[model samples]
Target: MAVLKEKKLGAELRSVLEAAFPGQEARYFLPMSIGNAPEHADEGAALILEGRKTLTSSPLWDYLDGTIPFVGALGVLLDGAGQPRGVVETTCVEIMPFRAVTEDMVRAYGEGERTLEWWQSVIGNLYRTSAIRHGATFTEDTPLIWEWFRVVRRL
Candidate 1:
């Protein structure tokens, strides 16, 4: 996969957002595929660009600590190479336990046949890995932040 410096990618994203939303306050430009491998980052960005993926889940603690992402936010999706791929606007946010994640929400995620079983298998692994890395515990009761977004512009 192609790679660029994060600073360069951020600058490019800023320019695109500025031109697209002139005179508006700048919005956050975020890299995609947190807690996953580089290839998954590429896949996630592609899914967003194709408009197949609209919802993403993360550990609720991340949001509470202001690490990244929030409701009603705008972000530029970045591929594995750290290239800006598109812009997205968050439309909804929900905080719930992992067990509470609905099949409908997983379907909206639009990954791997969009099945609940697939979501469980994939996200369960991701959460487990992230938990180990962060010294946290992963369980069905683990808090999650589910965010729904819409692609507003493709670059």
Candidate 2:
């Protein structure tokens, strides 16, 4: 198995995604492999361009694993030199929305609650402004994970 040496995984991923789609908004979702995770299905991260957080799901906590599920999103902006113009937006989502506090999971993370770290992790990743429509699909404007890795490995 190959190890990920890239310091900024999110930044690197954003560039490749943007290159695949010039002047267009692109989105991606990849599984996050957390080392030393409990016995359960590994969750994934949903990456997308900056300022776009319309695609997201509810907090999904796996009772089997004590570790929290993480979802990440990103946006890549480039200039004439092909360098990073700017990062428009970024977000993260957690599966388990109501497991942080025993006394009041909802109260702790809900609109009005304790407002702890876990709550931020769960709510921050979500896109509250918009919601996923019925029967929607990704446009696949950029190369898939495998394809992008193949080229990068050759470099």
Best-performing candidate as measured by TM-score: 1
- Give the per-residue lDDT digits (tens) of candidate 1, residues 1-155: 11111322356667777776666544554545433456867887887788888888877544434555566567777776766687788788777888886788877877776878877887788788777977899999997877788988887
Model 2 C-alpha lDDT per residue in residues 1-155, reported as the tens digit of each score: 00111123365655455565445433432222211122111111111122112222232111113332223233333332333333322233433322233334323222324345543444433312111331222221211111011111100
What lDDT score goes with residue 73 in model 2? 33
TM-score (C-alpha, index-matched) for candidate 1: 0.82
RMSD of each: 4.1, 16.7
lDDT of 1 at 29: 45
lDDT of 1: 0.69
Worst 10 residues of 2 by lDDT: 146-155
The residue pairs that clash in candidate 2, if any, are 49-75, 50-75, 50-89, 59-95, 60-95, 60-96, 61-95, 61-96, 92-125
Pairs with steric clashes in candidate 1: none
